[model samples]
Target: MSTDLLQARDLTIRGEGVTIAPFSCSLGPGDRLTLLGETGSGKSLIAQAIMGTLPKGLCAQGRLVIDGEAFDAADSTSRRALWGRRLALLPQEPWHALDPTMRAVSQVAESHRHVAGRDRRAAFQAAWSDLTELGLAEAGSKLPGELSGGMAQRVAFAAASAGGAPIVIADEPTKGLDAPRRDAVVELLARTPEAAGALLTITHDIDVARRLGGEVVILRQGQVVERGPAQQVLTDPQSEYGQRLLAAEPSRWPLPKPLGERQAPVISASGLAKTRGGRELFRDLSLTIVPGEIVGVVGPSGCGKSTLGDMLLGVTRADNGEIDRAQGHTLGFQKLYQDPPAAFSPHWRLSRLLDDLVRRHRLDRAAIPPLMARLGLDENLLGRRPGEISGGELQRFAILRVLLLEPCFLFADEPTSRLDPITQRQTLELLVELARERHCGVMLVSHDPALIERICDKRISLEATPSVAKRELDPVMA
Candidate 1:
């Protein structure tokens, strides 16, 4: 009998004549392992290779074993059967992972159908119970667009866990979540592997690894730099790469200054109302953002967080609200979307993009290099296009572009949603520093309650207004 549940021996991956040399790791039953690395360090690539989802040009050469059975990458039928039944994956991008057209419940049910070979009714019934267990009671009827980042992730977890896969691979599972939600998701992931089998989690969040209590494997440039027990590697690492990663953890970042008693509001809104597709998203909403203050907006998914961000940035006009902007108050808003690649022009280099923004805004060119350095970006990266950069780098660059504008008010829409925990912490620290030095009022829109608690000076919850017929439901609800 094999001692290992999943084993990879001399596993090598090659792309474009360059080789990602053989690196091996093994997992025992109920054992969890985390693959740690920077954005472009082939963490996801390894996960993809395991799932047989590598890009067309890339080829894999190695030995893979599951429960003493030899695994062949060349066999498509065998690979498919093993993929979701015995080997499951919780992908990085939940938005893309889920079909937007289908209802959330239906998608989860479909996973059950495909993996467990359950009938349609049985699958649908299973989805509800699974969703409820995942803390999503009414998630069955909602589409992916209607869910927040956190909610979508929970739904994905439900789908993956429902399959009873012995080996599960999760990539950056808690990327954009707030501390509490991050904890919840991490706990769920940690517990899932124990109940079913072993787990392989790819993450930049050290906290997640620590909480999961697993072995740690540090990857750099498509190779393993270090592998050891999680506690030793995180708390007292011998490798420089491990040290750098530990340093990058979010806990190390300094907290923002608290908001003192204020006499005047820096930005005020009254009767703020926005409508789309004959639906009233927000109505008569009032809020104040003070200078040197971080106001966090939180609500359920599809509650108009992004729309409100647009209104704050003057990107979208409010039909009914009066927005009072302070005199000479320029808004240097850096909106970080969930898909960073979509925000930038594919044809333009990072240098060209920054240069164009600076020229258009007529900002100081001399400040660009220093600012980029402060954001931990190398001057060499300026020549690379968005496609050439990792998600984390692209996110930092996007924010850097906004920093160059140097506005008084900064409107960030889920800015750290796509970033790893390490980068997330750094980005938050950078934002706080910018706010303090520049004395800017920042309005942050996020679904993570923990992030709001950690970073914001004030928090506001948006409630949907009930219809006239449903007035008894409560006015305080909105």
Candidate 2:
């Protein structure tokens, strides 16, 4: 008889400032289940609960059985023993699971040697093979710090499967990867356990859920609002919360109507070509954005979309291209970077940085509170540093800062990727509305086809380069 690998009965998880109400589920052999929800919706928390790795100040109640053994959240000794041998997790944040000082190869190799009891030399060889499978063989020697965000994520995933554990759990496995990498990761996980298909994924990306093809449990504010086959749940969620979430899917959202009679081009590029690491991302690409125009640059990961943003802002020089900037612009270009936490100084208080933007740009301080509230931010967070807040909160703050600048051109690179679904829609809409009010030209870079369709006036696609195969784009149009 097939036995359940992991089971959580009437699980309730809560932390200092968060709560996850009663939710229940089970994962057995050949079971492919995805726990789906937005950021802070307790998706990660549930995974941590099963692994007995809940964060400090957080507690879990009710029954959890792992591999036919009762699990204890605070039993450090057994937890270490169980990891990689019986249970392995790919944490959402790569840095959280990776050791900064250790070389990437050694760390992943440790999993093979320690958990699986492989010979020392054999473990090292197997580690390389694992990295190769993930398309990260060249990065094996590099430390986690040396890798990019997406590379680190891939490495962490490689480590998760190091011991050939029967049950694998990955949290937001596709978070930083581009479309090609995302699809590759999904394929690798789908073939997990030698095709037995015992994999559990926790993520907010609905498209990812559909691709994985399994049972889905839709979570909201820590509650199980709906559950069913992945296709049905994603395609036609019955509950109100489920309906709202699906409605907010970027593909389903309605695109804003055109801004009739666009003004003269605020920025124009001609013959733009950039090469990075001996690979051409896009060659001879040209685009122009008029005042109030929202031009979305769409492409798979590593397709030079962000590089194009740099070229437009005159930050990174294109190998062969010229960009014309409007003359005497009141405010120049400003960027909402892909990663908000990295953009701010760790040493600076949030309030101090915000204050500087307000004073420098002569922004109306009175409008700050309301804006922060709308973004679901707590004003008390202003006293803390960027490291003190979550990525979602920091992203909202980053957007608020750019709005204060009131720049003539806004380079928003996946600004809402970290936000929850509702907030994603609200934030993007607010950005476009503010841009229209200021007649700003926006260059939005993203891998989300739904988002590009909903907000962009002109869609510019960065064709696939040799480094990344598979053009996972919506219909190709100039």
The number of the candidate with the highest TM-score is 2
Cα miss at 298, model 1 (Å)?
6.1
Model 1 weakest 10-residue run by lDDT: 468-477
Q: For candidate 1, write residues 211-304 as lDDT tens digits.
A: 8877998887677889899988889989887887777554454454656666466678887888765667777778877667787777655456
Cα lDDT computed for each candidate against the true fold: 0.74, 0.78
Error of 1 at 368 (Å): 8.2
Assess every candidate by TM-score.
Answer: 0.74, 0.84
| Model 1 C-alpha RMSD to native | 6.2
Q: What's the number of clashes in each of the models?
A: 2, 0
Q: How far off is residue 276 in model 2, in Å?
A: 1.6
Cα RMSDs, all models = 6.2, 4.0
Model 2 agreement with the true structure over 1-478: per-residue lDDT tens digits:
4388877788887656667898787777778899876656778777777787775567888776777787654453455667887788987767767898998889889988988889899999999998888778778989987676677888888887888777788887887677788999998888763456368898767778899887999887778889999989888889998888878888777867777887888888888878886677777677778888888877766567787888888888999978998888666788898767667887888999988877887889987898787677778678767755456677899998887776888999888877667778888888888889889999888778768888888777776664443323232232
Residue 8 lDDT, candidate 1, scale 0-100: 81
